[model samples]
Target: MRDILVFLIVFGSIPYILRNPVVGALMWVWISVMSPHTQGWGFATTFPFAYIIAVCTLASLVFTRQPRNLPTAAPVLALLAFTVWMNVTFPFSLYPEYAFPQYTRVMKIMLMTFVVAMVIKSKEDVRRLVWVLVISLGFYGVKGGIFTLRSGGGQRVWGPGATFIGDNNALALALIMVIPLMYYLQQTSTNKWVRRGLTASILLSALAALGSYSRGGLLAIVAMCGFMWLKSRKKLMVGSVLAAVGPALLLFMPQEWASRMDTIDNYQADASAMGRINAWYMAWNLARDRIFGGGFEIYEPATFAAYAPVPNDVHAAHSIYFQVLGEHGFGGLALYLLVGITTWRTAAWIVKNAPKAPGMQWAVEMATMMQTSLMGFAVGGSFLSLTYFDVPYYLMCALVATRVLVQANLPPPAPTMTRPG
Candidate 1:
């Protein structure tokens, strides 16, 4: 029954995806983010639903009337550069079989991101995309939050297996990023009940992050809070809400959680932290030595012997910076960094310029929220090598799409002048 239902939901949308590629994009995002098929005993487990959706959606785009709003700009070009570089580095991969499969998956995500930038034309489309993302990802956050309250944050909150957010740390990072999107939706929503629900969702998602017992999540949350408070239109109200919920959450966690969190201060003494540091150094040293680096699955014991400080510890490149550097060399890392930093600056520019224009107020709100999400990723990702993840790039694509609409339809605000001191 579950399999049948999932099949209907996934396959039923194919026709609509052909009619409107944007809807198809939303469905793809929903499945990728939510992994609804992975929830339980369902035929979706074996069914190639995602591949089918991708094929149908792209085929649909070729036949349907496209909005042609796709920006032929720097972000897209950077993405293409990064994608090409990945393929270039793949032949040098230490484990070609492992690297090729992962390469295909990431390439698909990149292609879909470009598709989204093409199909989504207006602010409302962006809003709806955010809604779908929040609902898909927030479902787990809210559910995990309630479970934390009931379990006292003793048991860790994990994600659906075989997905990007399969581990506690990964799930926590994802939840942290989506919280800002949830807030964006809440701010734009006119329905009072929706506002209330989103408020609860934010608190719940935070709790879920805490429940994951992820040190990186905790750090990211702190950074996120500082920005959230500063970026908010109403600082006082946001502060008050944080003040109310923060203490309660801390008190809810068990002594085990507390002791685990205390390890953050003494990271050098912690085996896991030390292992990550060693991996970072290995990636850095190896990238400096090899022009194309070691490529995927480069963290073997022998590779460590060549470059790692310890020369014995075999560890994954747990930091995003190291992950890209090790996998694709300096050229790939440079391209990746340029894309992210440029997207962030673009978002900031949008936030500054979109407010005065009523038609593009949603862009202002979204760009502001995008900054918070980027903050979470930039901070949390330092401790984890999720360089190939989709969420951040998707946010960047949203910013690109929004910038096109806001820039064309609305004029820039007059620059303010200050008196000489």
Candidate 2:
């Protein structure tokens, strides 16, 4: 029954996707971000919904008169450069067989990311994309919040299976990032019920993040909250809410959760933490030795034996920074960082320059929330190997799209008289 429903929904959307490529893009984002089929039993669980949708979207984009102008924004260009760099390292991959599969997955994500930038022409289109994200990811957030409440925060909160956010830690970070977007929705929503629902979703998502029992996630939430408070216009209200809710959620968790989070400070005694450090060292060493790094899946025991200070300690490069450094090298890491920094600056530029006019407020809000989400990703991703995750890339696409709209709305600067100099 579940499989049938999912199949019908995905297949039924094709007609609409063909007429409007934006629908296909949103459906693709929903499938990729939510992995709704993963929640079902039978054929739907294994179906290649994203690929089918992507092919259709591309065909529609070509057949239709939709403009395919790729934005020349710094972030967009850096992302393209990064994608090209990823492919360049393919031949040099220490484990070609393993690297090939990872390469295919990441390339698909990057492909869709560019598709988003092209299809997103107006503020409404961007809002539709955000709606898909909130509905999809927030499904887990709302469910996890209820689960945490029911379980008394004893068990961990996990995301959809067979996806980037399958683990508790990954889901935690994803939720933390989405909370700010939820707030954006709440603030902009005129309907009282919609605002209330979003308000509840925001609180529930925070609870879901707390219930994940991830030490790195804990740090991430703390860092994100601090940044959100700093960026907010109504500091007193935001601060009051944080002050009231923060301690209550922490106290709601079980002692075991506290014990695990305590290891953040005493990481020397924690085997998992020590292993991550060992992997970081291995990545740094490999990046120094290889021009293009060791390529994908280079965190194998053999590579560790050759490069790791503690060669016997075979572990994944748990940090995003180290993961890219090991898999792609220093150059790849540079490009990756460049994409993030440029995207961030683009958001900042929008917030600073976008007029306070009624029609332009959405762009400002989107840019502000984009920064908040990036804050969560930056801090949470430091200890998580999510270098190839699609959410951050989508956030970059959002910022670029918003920047384009904001630029169009801004007035031209006045001409300066050369004689004055």
Candidate 3:
């Protein structure tokens, strides 16, 4: 039944997507990020819904009269450059067979990201996309939060299987990133009941993150909350609340969660932590030796044996920074970092400029919260290989689109007349 419903909804939307490719892009973001099909059983679980949506979207894009244009923002340009660089290094991949599949996956994500940038034309479109994200990922946030509460944080909250966020740690980081977006919606929404419900969702999602018991997630929450407070207009009030709530939530978690987090301070004693360090070292060594890096799937035993100090201590390049470094080499890592740095700057620009346009305060809030989300990703993803995650890229797309709208709506500067120069 669940599978049938998912199938019906997805297939039902194809016509609308063909009419307006933006719908396809939004649906693409939904299926790709949330992996709703993964929630169902039977045929829907194996169905290639995303591929169908992508084809329909591209067909619509080619046929539709709608004006298509990518944003000229620095972030978008950097993303394009990074995409090209990925292709450049593909032929040089150490294990092209393993790398090809992952490379294709990343390319698809990049393509959809650009589609989002081109199609999202208005503030309403941005809001709609935000709603899609919230509803899709927030399902996990709300459900996971409840599970955490009911289990007394004794069990971990996990994402749907076979998805990027399927792991507990990945799900926790994903939730942490989404929480701020929830806050953004709550702030912009006029409905009191909706705001109230969102507040509850926020609390539950935080609990869910705790339930995951990911030390990196815990650090990310701290970093994100701090950055969020810094961005708030009422910093003192926000700071006060955070100061009060932070410890209370931590105390509520079970002893096991505490012990796991405690390992952060004594990482040398933790085997998992040590393994990650070894992987990081391997990535660095590979990048130093090879110009284009080892290409995708470079975290194999052979690569680690060649580059890792402890040849026996092989592990995935758990860090996003290292993941790019090992797979793409120094140039790829530079482009990857450039994408993030430029996105951050672009969001900051929107925050600064959005206020100049009256009634654009929502844009300000959006950019600010997006920055908070980026902060969470940057911190949490440091310990996780989510370098190719669609969520962050989509966030960048929204930010880039938001900047475009904000700039367009911004009142033209009053004409200046100079007497004598």
Off by over 4 Å in 2: 356-358, 415-421
Q: Weakest 10 consecutive residues, lDDT, candidate 2?
A: 353-362
lDDT of 2: 0.90
Tens-place lDDT per residue, model 3, 326-381, is 98888988998999999999899999999898788898999999999999999999
**CA lDDT, every prediction?**
0.87, 0.90, 0.91
Residue 23 local lDDT, model 1: 83
Tell me, by lDDT, which candidate is best: 3
**What's each prediction's TM-score?**
0.95, 0.97, 0.98
- The digit string of per-residue lDDT tens for model 2 on 1-421 reads 8888889999999999999899999999999999999888899998889989999999999987877788888999999999999999889999998888888889999999999888887788889888888988899999999999999998989998879999899999999889989999999989999999999998898899889888888898998889989988899999999999999988988999989988898999999999999999999999999989988888788999999999999998888999999988999999999999999999999888786433687888888887989989999999999998888888887788888888787777779868764
All candidates in order of lDDT, best leading: 3, 2, 1
Global local distance difference test of model 1: 0.87
Candidate 1 segments whose C-alpha is farther than 4 A from its true place: 412-421
Q: At residue 239, what lDDT does model 2 achieve?
A: 100
Better of 1 and 3 by TM-score: 3
lDDT of 2 at 13: 100
